[model samples]
Target: MKLNVKKFENQLLQRLRDLKISNKKVLLAVSTGVDSMVLLSGMLKLSKVLDVEINVAYIDHQLREQSKEETKFIKEFCFARNIPLYVYRWEKEEHPVQSIEAAAREVRYNFFEKVLKENNIEYLVTAHHGDDQAETFLMKLIRGGNIQQLQAIQSVRIFREDYQIVRPMLIFNKKEIYDYAKQLGIKYYEDETNKSDDYQRNRLRHHIIPVLKAENPEFLKHVLEYTQQLTNNLQAIQEVADVKLNKISKEETLDYNKFVKESPLWQRILLERYLEVKGLEIKETQVQQILAMLNDEKKPQAKFDLNEKFEFYHEYLKIGIRIKSTTSLNLEENFELKLNQWHNLEEGKKIGLFKINEIELMPGDETLVVEDNENWVIRHRQPGDSLKMSFGNQKIKKVFIDKKIPSEQRNKSWLITKNKNEVYWILETKKTDLSLAPQNAKIHYILVFRKK
Candidate 1:
């Protein structure tokens, strides 16, 4: 089939327009392959019409003897066109067992990311066409991947916080890519490894995809549509999950009862999102295992080790890193309770005492009044510290036990006192309304805690 250069150029322009990359610096990942060469050719043509700046990058995997020659050819090609070219050579590492394809991809991307940061490149472009997407989908599907994974390649994806990877040629098929390259008279070296059936993708491309295409010439088009639909559905489901999760999530815990009441599919989704926010990863089986632990009636207060770094307590579904207790505040020797100012506490926590009239108090925040001549000190709990509660005078140790504050945390907990006789405020736990002020008290203090 003859390539319609005008049609291909129009398509390329439309894709770039949709990506909103008209004036952006794009680093194109090019191999001496037909797909990449055609992409380079198309971009060169678009450069005349658009304001986009393009640079080429090539990674020599060092797996083939001809890789050196292919790298030289790409360097010369870019030089002839007056385009900047970056070349990275892979360094092999000794591992007991490794997938060469996966290892090569990791090394190539690490280099690309480093270059992007060094040069302030906004977009990393690759020539992943429709056939590559289909092969990826089929491989992940056969390997029992979830819906999101089955969708495979995306047109544009965030590579880092502000950088993106774009596949503008994903709208084209392999045959169209070859035709376009041929029509432009672009020279590209073929990778013999691509034709070898040692890799699963190669086996699919050489053996399975042809038979499927023979049965239905438009099989790939349908697959692309199906994957798009799956992507849309996954996005919608994620939106709903996010809304529900936000409603029941707290700073350090998930509402266990509400999370358990959700449907199984939503439970999985919510857990996945929660873990993602925590910067943790859990497999499907681990998710199920956690749910089972939550549902187990015999162990109402069970604790599960998520990994070396984290632990999950069942009753409240609190997931947090298992960190050592902070050292004692040692307030007896060094610290004093300063009024009307914030004090820096251990562990990025801050405490402030203000007059109730000085700041509007939120609900659940405690307020109190103190005598003018009273002296106060901020200190960690002592052996016999007691707080005057609504019920009566209660030992601070009893309060910690009743609230189920971890033993490690209790050792580091802070307390405020007007005298050595009574504890008035326990930071982050509760404050005692010690009605010890004069009838017309002139000084009121509000103790507040905040994270830095």
Candidate 2:
């Protein structure tokens, strides 16, 4: 087939202009594959016409034996064309045992980031075409997610604060890229692993995508058109969602009572935007978990672990995402219990010992009522301390073990005690018989714990 060389070059040149990457120092992430080779060749041609500064970055992952040959070819190609090249060889010893593909990608991007920063490049150009976008869209669709996940492979996005990553080749399909490279006599190496069905993408590429294309000749074009449309729609939705979120959200906290009034779709959009602003990826399960926690009428307060470092929590009318604190609270150390005052603890935790005549409690407030003991002290678990339960005196250690409280958390959990070594309340985890105030008791105390 005869290739429309000028048409392809013009389209790429226009894309560069549209992304505003023309006449700027841009680094090309090349892999000596057809798609990237076409990108490199096209950019070299455009550099002369548009006065764009071209630099090449190639990560020799060293996973395949052909990497050595590819590296030599790229070196000679760059030298002959008078283009600057940056190459890094990822040693086999450094490769991970599992998820090697993802790990290699991380390493490759890290290297590209280093090169871009050291060389002061403004844009990192990549060769992700329309076919890749279609595959990614289908993959995420099968996996299930919100619209943001369905919309794949952005043509231009922020790589960091100032630098941007641009994919001009996204305007073309995979076959167009290969044909362009062939017509221009651009030397490229094919990755054999791309044909293997061991990877999901490869499986799609070999079996599913071809079948889809066979059914509809313009599948890639339609996919690209839909992707762009989705991108535009998301921008509009995000603008509206941002406004809605700002009204109900304060810092990391959201007024969930007000948030629940919005439509379910809007709620999802708002939550997705909220996490995006906080730089957290929202998984489908996480979104459902958070929504269930927020909407559950029975459970006034609940928490879901988003990851090891972060958590989503709903308390009364408020819900929010926060970083999980690693602070260890010493239960053995006692603090002077001040009456009628909220004592601040580590990680925005608060405890109060208030003298009250009537029992009044709010949702999410863990309270324990006991006979007024002027000598009450606030502390965590201690040796030989036991909770006075209905059946018998249960060891504080045994209570924690029975409750299945994690050891790390058992040490950090707070407890209210009086008369030394008598555990009155195990905070939110449990309430002992000692928590009940005597019927004729003149004085009563309510120990409350809250997370701000």
Quote each prediction's TM-score.
Answer: 0.71, 0.74
Tens-place lDDT digits, model 2, residues 1-452: 67799999999999889988767888999999999998898888888777889999999899889999999999999999899999998999999899998999899888988998999888999999988988998998888867777678888888767678898888798888888887878889999999889889888988999999999989988888888899899899889988898899866699878899999888888888888888888678888878877778887667889889998877666788878878755546887677787889878878888887543566888777766747777787777878878888888887876775655567777777776566777876887764378888888778778876
Query: Considering only N, C-alpha and C atoms within 3 Å, which residue pairs clash in candidate 2?
Result: none
* Model 1 lDDT per residue over 72-172, tens place: 89988999989999998875453225677777788788888888988989899999988998899889978773456888888888886678999888788
Measured with C-alpha atoms, the lDDT of residue 152 in candidate 1 is: 89
Candidate 2 vs. true structure, TM-score: 0.74
Q: What is the C-alpha lDDT of each candidate?
A: 0.78, 0.83
Q: Give the C-alpha miss distance for residue 440 in model 2, angstroms.
A: 29
Predicted structure 1: clash tally: 0
Q: Per-residue error at 419 for model 1, in Å?
A: 27
Candidate 2 residues lying further than 4 Å off, grouped into runs, are 325-452
